[model samples]
Target: MNAPPLELLAARGTDLLVRVAAVACAARELPQLAEELAGLVVRCAEELTFCDVYVLDDDGRVLEASNRPPVPLGDADVGWVAAHGCARPHADGRGVAIPVRCDGATIAVVDVRSAGRCRDEDVALATALAGLFAPVLSSCRRLRAAKEREHAAERFAERAVEVQEAERSRLSREIHDGIAQRLAGLGFHLSAAERALPDDLPETAQQIALARRLCDLAAAETRAAIGGLRPPVLDDLGLSAALATLAREATAARLHVSVTVSGELEDALPDHVQTALYRIAQEAVGNCVRHASATCVDLLLEHDRDRVRLTVADDGVGFSIQDVFAPGRRPDSYGLRGMAERAELLGGRVSVTSRPGVGTTVEAVVPVPASRGRREAGGPG
Candidate 1:
């Protein structure tokens, strides 16, 4: 079959090379542009029976074909093109290998083979297409690198939270076991002294009684501190009881708070998921109390066999979500961003819906299997 004129093919190919660049730029990796690269070469350079795209492996010694299986090309010019950043024509005049360069180094080699003698225009067209792809490949590499770094940062942040929770647990144990126990012992001794003091020494009895009361107060405060560090109820009972306790102890002076936990598999959640849920609820409640001057708040948690959903809704003075989540405009005490980041780290999500004077609802949905799969030791319980 006769092919289009060389001038027309060259003109059309040059125009489509721009399309190639657009495709390659959006592509996150080389393999994504493999088919386009092969088609570009074959359609424009019609003398070629086939086209092959090869990228260097990490070691830079082996070549990897992105479009098809690697075969013995029986021509070593592909390597020469990659190494020298120049096109190498087959000694038999049937093929040409063109280097795809970025920043003075070749990232790929394009090989076009003909059934007969390869046209000079076909070889030049191959070279021009390779040049167009080079910059786009560079951009793709940068994008992939940025994504890898973002993933690394997420891992680091999650690990940091885990370490912080471990420390909190250790401190809680120290306070509960050491200081609280000693205070209790001191209170017992003070009580015994007060009881032994007779009706004759009224002043002395009053002083001992006061000391005992102070000791009891100190012990209560210590226990409260332990609960704050990492609530013991979360470990002793489970997430539902812990959320109920959280609801009771919430410092919403004006809001009437209610916690309703209903689920078939309340005990199925992992430790981290439970902890994250608790924290997200805590943040939402805090937001409601401090920002949303709502009259009432509801903490609802429901779980099925597969996943868990916790919703914190408040009928308060709601604000625009766009304003809250705006870049560089987050309020000083806003925890929505932190909540979202934490949920994402655990393979979950938090959605907040609100408007001016309407209401605000924060809903967190987490897949139990995914969270359980990446479960760590501790979190903000």
Candidate 2:
């Protein structure tokens, strides 16, 4: 056999380098990379006439293929390379099987086929190409793993929110049916007893009056608890009315809070969406009163054609947003996390902006299904 000319070898080497770079750039995903690798092996080696690529997943099953039919998992040569993480010529001396590794673990096996027998140079080139793919594949695998974990976390968060809501509903019913009812009945009995007292029994009448006052206080407290557990306004009047009630309560707490609406919100939102937005607003307002020390707060609800936005802004002394969200910086930032989790479950997002001197604003934007009427003309019920 005659040696190829130096010029021909140099040209092939340059062409191979260019082709490898192209393959690297084009290999974004596992399947695309596998196909490119198989094609590159054949094109890079002058002795190879035809080539086939097979990419095996972690379980030794064929994940992708290029220019060839799927290879059986039980093929001795392919299985051996996958199991032992090595490279070798095919049993019939027509191709090479190379194990693709990442972080010291075999992830895939690349099988390159040729019409004629493969040469030593061909095998070496195929091995080098597979080596180049290892890191890329590793990075891709890690990315995919990270995405899967994120999805799992979101799923877990959603489930937690659902359970929390269920528990709240149950507790609210218990408080309303058991405690609130009993308190109301007690108030009625106290009134009846006071009426039955004689005009001459002044001391007894005074004691009865004090007992009635105490019964009224207890009943009021029970009603407050029931409202806190589950706001009846939310179910009866929808999100806008519920937010108006929140603003009124904030005002009573000495926080100058106002509620504003941009678009008419006549049509009711999905129950879950309305609940999430209301909770977010409620938490934001509470945070302002508790920590912001702001004299005035503004709550805005905007209903657009496709989405609704809620903004809670307070003209108070603001804190560092980063520090609040940083690890171990603020242990009391669970409210913010809860807000974000709730919005995320509805495929929405929450954003908070604040500076040291300027006011802070928390905004939540949630996409509404098109099936829901956007142009409905109604005010907060």
lDDT top scorer:
2
When summed lDDT is taken over every stretch of 10 residues in candidate 2, the lowest stretch is 372-381
Clashes of 1: 0
Per-model TM against the reference: 0.55, 0.60
Cα deviation of 265, candidate 1, in Å: 15
Expressed as tens digits, the lDDT of each residue in 198-297 for candidate 2 is 8999999899889889888888878777776678899899889999999998897799988998885445566767788999998999899889999999
